[model samples]
Target: MTMGSGGSSIVVPRNFRLLEELERGEKGIGDGTVSYGIDDGDDIYMRSWTGTIIGPHNSVHENRIYQLKLFCDKDYPDKPPSVRFHSRINITCVNHETGVVEPKKFGILAKWQRGYTMEDILVQLKKEMAAPPNRKLVQPPEGTFF
Candidate 1:
């Protein structure tokens, strides 16, 4: 919910927000570097999703495609979704064994606000791939999955 022009509360329903995200995902995000969609078209709640990120250039992950799963529970938008990489990766913010993006280690999840979207998360992960330390780190062979 947000305060309107007259200090009135404006609330965007969860399904409405997810639907908007779905539409944007279908239309394709900028540069096609990141994208996501509903995991199951039959899911009325729109809870599970699949995200893909093309690793940033000039990094070890360059040209590599990474897949991830996102689970948005009942409180999404108000609460961040659970993100886990399906493609194996070695990043400071991701758990080595389980591939989960650790909230305490990732600023986006740690300081989540209602305004953040799934696209934001995927894009940020791509940015993380280009950032220092991670850029030069050796990665598992391509096509490997968790």
Candidate 2:
């Protein structure tokens, strides 16, 4: 099946299931909202999703809104989704390779499992922002925006 506007095609089983979960989550299955996009004709299965993260309580990010992006490949579900902070979040734990902000202090992104949904990742990111282990840590260099 294909979704969105990139011509990307998703094989029926795993990728389709993940897409369904994303739709459900957008419909209020979880805390935040998620939006998805796919190419028009390609079968490569590259999907992109956007979501919001409510800053954690009692922290610098608390009450502030953050944006998140999720990139899923054709092999999704079998492999974890690539997640990153879309809004300006200054942090050091972000993976230099994938450009996704890593809340290593909480070990959530690092411990991602296949059964995890996009909602799970968003929730974990919110938890990490709410109570980061190193609140005093400074954001990485200015050009690190992904």
**Model 2: per-residue lDDT, tens digit, 1-146?**
44656877654587567657656754664434333333332544647766676666666665666666777777777666777776667555556455576545336556766666667777766665545563444544433445
Candidate 1 lDDT over residue span 63-98, tens digit each = 999999999999998999999999999989999989
Taking all chains together, the TM-score of candidate 1 against the true structure is 0.96
Q: Using alpha carbons, what is the TM-score of model 2?
A: 0.65
Error of 2 at 34 (Å): 8.2
Name the regions of candidate 2 deviating beyond 4 angstroms.
1-12, 29-46, 95-99, 102-106, 132-146
Residue-level error in angstroms, candidate 1, position 3: 5.4
lDDT of 1 at 72: 99
Clashing pairs in 2: 5-39, 6-38, 6-39, 6-40, 7-39, 7-40, 7-41, 7-42, 8-39, 56-130
